[model samples]
Target chain A: MAGQPHYREAHPLVFVMTHWVNLICMIMLAFSGFYIHFPFFPGFMGVARGMHFFAMYVIIINLTFRIVAAFTVKTATDLGSREVDTDIKNWLPQEKNKHQFFETVKYYLFLRKEGVISAKYGSLQKMAYLATIPLTYLQAYTGFAIYGPTMKGGFFAAGTTLVGGPMNMRIIHYFIMWVFIVFTMIHAYLANIYNFNPSKIIFAWKETDH
Target chain B: MAQEAHGAIYDLLAVRGVSRRDFLKYCSYIAATLGLSEAAAPQIAAALEKGAKLKPALWLNGGSCTGCTESMAQVDTPDVATIVLELLSFNYFETIMAAAGKQAEDNIAETIKEGNFILVYEGSVMTGQDGNTLIVGNKEDGSPKKGTEILAEAATAAQAVISVGACAVDGGWVAAYPNPAGAMGVQAFLDKEGIATPVVNIPCCPMNPEWVVAMVVQWLLVADDDPAVFLEKTALLTKTYKDGITGADVTLNYPEYVVGSTIHDNCPRRGHFENGEFVSEFGSAEEAMGYCLYKVGCKGPQTFTQCPVTRWNRSVSWCVNSGAPCIGCGGLNWVDNNAPFFKRLSSMQMGGSLGNVQPGSVAAVVGGVAAAALVAHGLGMKAAGRIGDGPPMETAKKYDRKRMAKGGDK
Candidate 1:
């Protein structure tokens, strides 16, 4: 038993709700945002705009709630660890996930096999996740800064002036959306690669107990 | 048949020395032109009656060539439509006003101070050189008066500001790229200064007089005793495209009904567009056939304005109908974004190092590069023995263990 690598199980309820929220929010945001960007049909403009704005507010609220919950919620840390950890800490790095960037790269490049695996996340994964938090906030900020009433306000006015004009700012916002799209694509593909377990836990909220 | 109405028709005909019958006939024709029902003739006749006593309107030339105001003089049909101006009073007009600078300025100031006049503003608002770009009249020292200062004073006490021509709406060609002279349209400039007074925009290179007439009629329809009240109501409808200085919002807040659809929607030559008939070259047989200008880069598809229905030059011809492709002058930042008039789209302004890249082209190129890079990386992964086997486990673990037992924390 001492020789066995530590493995931890996540708190089923909080994780279940969070996973459902994230999946639903991301889907709703993408769908409604696209509809607002261009009305594919005529009758749906008002509806699409309503949905887009509603989704935006909902996603923002959900994200805020999720971030706060991360501190309180205990989730799995290591694949083989019995020690529980704060989900945010696990999502970020502990003392362990450092200088592993190139090593992970080398492993991906097939330079090394049986790469070091310790915590719940590898360095690369942690970074990609952390990076998304800021990028998401930035995308939202840019979006708000281009919004009609918001753009005229002093808060957004500074960003608009800095970027030259609203058009340029809007372009930045658009390009950043593409970044999120690519990120979501890569993320979904990577998460589902090993098995369907992650998808079950995250999307379907079906916890895998071993 | 040509003339014969009451005081309204008589006054209009009187301006050009036409007889009473001729005046009434002209009134009927004008009523028809304005798209009014024939039954509205007596009502129109009554309005003209009240209109004939009005003072001459002032047409002020700012940093403009007064082309639009000049075009206003060209409004035809025995010039009776113009006699409609006799309903109100015009104390001064730059091109034809008998008064000189000081006299014109004084009279306009008096009229505006009384708060009973139509202020017609022409040309771009010059903010370059601290308003030194356009000097309307000289100071006592014989130096020119700043355009901005004069504009502020003239605008503050006016009943209404009618911004004529593209330049007055935005900097126009004069305010093109780099906007060295800091030329901006009347409304945009006014917004910057926090002047909330309403402005009616009549757009075009020089602008059409019919639009002015329509606006005048619209104003007449909703004329109010308090200028401020009228201004407040019109300002609601007079919203400007906030970012015309940049081509961010392509369409300004033009009347939705007028610019709601593209010229492509209402073009007389739309049959050719669907038929795939195109004008390959200028003055070609296809051109004579009035083929669609889409292939030739007609901006009609992207442009929104009532040019097709409104036409130009006495409704005889317009851009596409005249064999000229649409240049999208009605678009915000029209000149900067729509010029290189011969081309379908604005050309990229090339500079050193970076190659000239159009917006659409840049998007395509960047997309292509990322796709190519992804494919190449995928091939590299396969070649490196990483495709079949997952990443190395020992190294990844070693890395994780090292992080878990960290030394220095930031």
Candidate 2:
């Protein structure tokens, strides 16, 4: 553990803060959302709805900010490396990520004893991470379609009709939340499986350098 | 004859103990429902008196419980008798018309031959068992005529078709899950047969009678008995849905005011909703306190109808006002969309042994399975000795090595 090299270039300070915001907002949104869906207890509906809406706006803003920062900020493209490149390059698929996708799968399946060599983020990880962006936006679109105030707007109403009706749109919104839950569970487990180094680096911004 | 017919409306109104002022006031109410200016009331009154020639209408019953007919009978302003006998000149009304059997059948034939009548159709268009589910009249060959055949013939000849009630609009409860009867709405049936006659949809379990009266008056005064003009003058919302049975697209025209906003927006108890006061249980103290019905499966938030504003049963009280949650009968495919009337969400018909399953139960089952799967995967990871410190890392990329061999940069 002492011999392993870690550097601040892997995850910039700005990203660390955004990651914390995303985590907090996700927890708050899910908790308040479940409450609003079917008030398990009485008297907190107003507070729950308020919290759900507030957390929704915060998460959406945070996600947009994080995406914009990716293009402007620079970070190490390779793990434990001092050399740097724009953060967006590391977030996207890179030359180092080429044919290692299958190997990564093989390693996870234990068909291979070692991990696949790739970019700062592995091929599969990059795909899953990129998918969340669109999924999150879709969650918001479905949410707005069922909401009383916005459901009548032309844009939202058209989408609602396309999906059948408001009831179906609501079911879609409910299902998307479950997708986020499963994704987060797997994400946390996989991220922490490797000695918790990724968590410490991303959350605490603490570098372990030799 | 024209002079005699003209006086008939006022004479009937007087006999019923209604004054000329009350009739004029009712005319103004209709004008308001049509979103017409107050100045248009006089013109409407004049139109009604002149419309004594009786543009002629045929009220046909299909596969329905006659609840819509019953609801229409409850209106007092223009009363059902005035509307059927004088206002519209209904030549064939099954429930109230004196002529029955062959006599009533002859009236429908005469109206169709005249070629300028309104067809007021109630209930679903039954197509099960080759449309034998509902028998209405006799064919030219003297055999029993299906309800479908009667509706098609009447709808084809009529200037316009007024689909009243949730059943006539979108099959209502009769066409709900697994619709064994193959019942469908009038619009859907017309579209399938490629009938080009225009349809005006007035929806509700047994639609509010005021909406029906407003549409009828709008046609007589505003549109001048022209179906095309009626459609042009009315503020209608076009709703299209895929037919569950035929899988074809069906379009319906709804008067905007009737289906414009959700019931929740105009709910008398909306303030209580915002204040977090809910009626959690029936007959509880909260119920007596007149709290919001949202908690007890009120579908008002998603159901688009002016029920709260118009009320029901002559505006005496609506569902929410009477301590019952709205079942969303005004919406298309309402029974399928908002059933289990007491639950927050409609149940999914899972066919066969499953019957109806609640959405919450489905979500819980899915979430539980996912959690259990993840736990098993974690155990597998531990068994494979790759839990802590994870799998070992590989060396340089294979692509990099291949590129270098091809004389590329290191």
TM-score of 1: 0.64
Question: Judged by lDDT against the true structure, how good is candidate 2?
Answer: 0.84
Segments in model 1 whose C-alpha atoms lie over 4 Å from true places: A1-210, B1-5, B14-41, B75-77, B85-88, B98-115, B192-196, B228-261, B271-288, B340-356, B375-379, B390-392, B395-399, B403-410
Error of model 2, residue B361, in angstroms? 1.8
How high is the CA lDDT of each candidate model? 0.63, 0.84
Interface RMSD of 1: 9.1
Write down the TM-score for model 2.
0.92
- Candidate 2 Cα misplacement greater than 4 A, ranges: A1-6, B1-7, B75-85, B396-410
lDDT tens string, model 1, A1-210? 011232225434666676576667677766666544433333444455466567667767777787888898777776645467678888765666666668667665556655445456778777887787778778778878866446556777567656644445655765676676666666765565344566665556554542
True contacts kept of 2: 0.54
| Residues A13-84 of candidate 2: C-alpha lDDT, one tens digit per residue | 998999999999999989988877777666777888898889989989999999999999999988679798
How well does candidate 2 reproduce the true complex, by DockQ? Answer: 0.51
